[model samples]
Target: MIPGGKSFCTRHYKKVTHCLFDLDGTLLDSEVMYHTMIGQICEKYGKSYSKDNAVQIFGMTDREVSEEVCARTRLPLSVDEFERQLLDLARNKLPIAPEKPGADRLLTHLFDYKVPMALATNSTEQSVRLVSIARPKLFGMFNHMWTAASRTRTSTSWRRVASRTNPSPHNASCSKTPRWACRLQSRLACRSLRDFKPELFGLPPFNEAPPSTTVPIHHS
Candidate 1:
């Protein structure tokens, strides 16, 4: 009996032979730190940065937000310098931000299944290095990683990744609600992405894609 896939596309869900995960919030517990840093940055610029603001930029790259800050608040520092500071802050804080509770277990089980995995993040190469060091056990399974330096970090890139990878489950950054961040209107919501076509959820293109017949049995 094939339980319906979480994504709208049956082809994607049923045929999913691999998994591609977004790094930061998906496997790690850095959402609070991310929210804090965004607050700190916005505060330095005399702008309002709140949890809501952090939520707003959930799936976006820091560079995009920095540009917005420069345009809106006219922040004095260069975006690169600003991003460096943010990364520095994150490095110092990584020890305290734990991995998400169930994520480690999920990753471990997936590894045991010999599931091929890829990690795609909007973070920089340095950030990736820092995270790998900060969470070695968690990152060891990833055979591939894509960072912000890639040509495909834009908002459009987000959509493209989802559309390009058939027979693979697209796991976005895992905040509490799993809603699309302003930058990531590309992928569908977590529930929709589980089996429904993202295009039907206002993220078309993958809309009405072939249906997947296999339902993965997940256990804690």
Candidate 2:
């Protein structure tokens, strides 16, 4: 059973045949680091950055986040300046951020089993590149990856990629963190990912020990 005693539905899980992933808190444990960095930037302008502030930018693109932060904080910096600061901090911090527990393990399992997977994140390609530098093997496992900007530019690309696994979007499971982070929200939380039973989703079971920490998962 999921949290709140929601009955687990094996019927629906059986239909899921593909997986899409988000990066920040999904594969990488860098969501907190991101919030901290934004707060630090806001503090420089004598503004406080709260969870509420972070929530406002949850599903936004990189440029949109910069613009929203600058506007909300009244930070004298232009959007470019604000984004530059974020990039500077990211350069120093993101590469060192650890991958979410079981992330590599799960991805490896899926890859080994020939599961069709893709990455669909709001992060810029540059940010993805930086993070990938720290874990090339893991990132390389995905069949496709797209930034928010790139996704918008090539809207049909997702469909083309999704077709590799199943023709319908309803057949894919989107793996992501927290409910509010995406337009297609799922009820399950990050804690469930750690204890996830692959057999529930008709996937091969893990033959090794589970990781030490929880992983977040969302289905769409």
Candidate 3:
């Protein structure tokens, strides 16, 4: 939905040959670490941190998170200070690292399907290298990993979804055109076109989706 505009898309980006994956939340359970750090930083600044407002920034990059901290908490600090605090917290909190459940399994499965994948993370070069140290095998897991700060780096490194029509029709008449093909955006990562969800696009997340085709797998 175009905010308020009824104007529909003349075209759509539907089928995705390549997929971008966010490392922190979408793949790794790093929110607990982030929030704990944020809360500590806010205490030092005498600012109240709201979890609800914090949840608004799950998929954001580090710079985006700093901006949100300023905007949401009205903290009296330059973005640089915020960044320092965040990094300090990262250093203190995450001495060792672990991958989210099913992460490697999913990577192997997607790789087996011959689908290209990239890791788009907000972490800087140093932090990115650190996170990588947590999983050196990650080099074989993804085609690339791009830090969000550098446009040139991310643009060239990460795989871009090639297909232009990731369409899913729900209530819209087959005769009528769709409002959009997909809602992919900056700092947001998505699965491939074949795994796209139609109903969860606009509305609240369903408690559970109706059971669809389930393929049995043998974990050797």
> Which candidate comes out best when scored by TM-score?
2
Reference-based lDDT, residue 168, model 1: 40
Candidate 3 or 2, higher lDDT: 2
* Model 2 C-alpha lDDT per residue in residues 1-220, reported as the tens digit of each score: 1111122445454433566677888899888888889999999888998788899987566788899988888998899999999989999899999888888878898789776678877888878889988889998887778776565622234454454543334423333234446345553344735676666666667887767697678898
- Stretches of candidate 1 off by over 4 Å are 1-15, 154-220
Q: Count the backbone clashes (under 3 Å) in each candidate.
A: 18, 1, 7
**Cα lDDT tens digits for candidate 1, 77-135:** 88887777777787887656777656665556556656556677887777678878867
When 1 and 2 are scored with TM-score, the better candidate is 2
Q: Ranking under TM-score, best-scoring first? A: 2, 1, 3
* Poorest lDDT segment (10 consecutive residues) of candidate 2: 1-10
Against the reference, the lDDT scores of all candidates come to: 0.59, 0.72, 0.57
RMSD of 3: 11.0
Worst lDDT window (10 residues) for model 3? 1-10
Runs with alpha carbons beyond 4 Å of true place in candidate 2: 1-12, 151-161, 164-190, 209-220
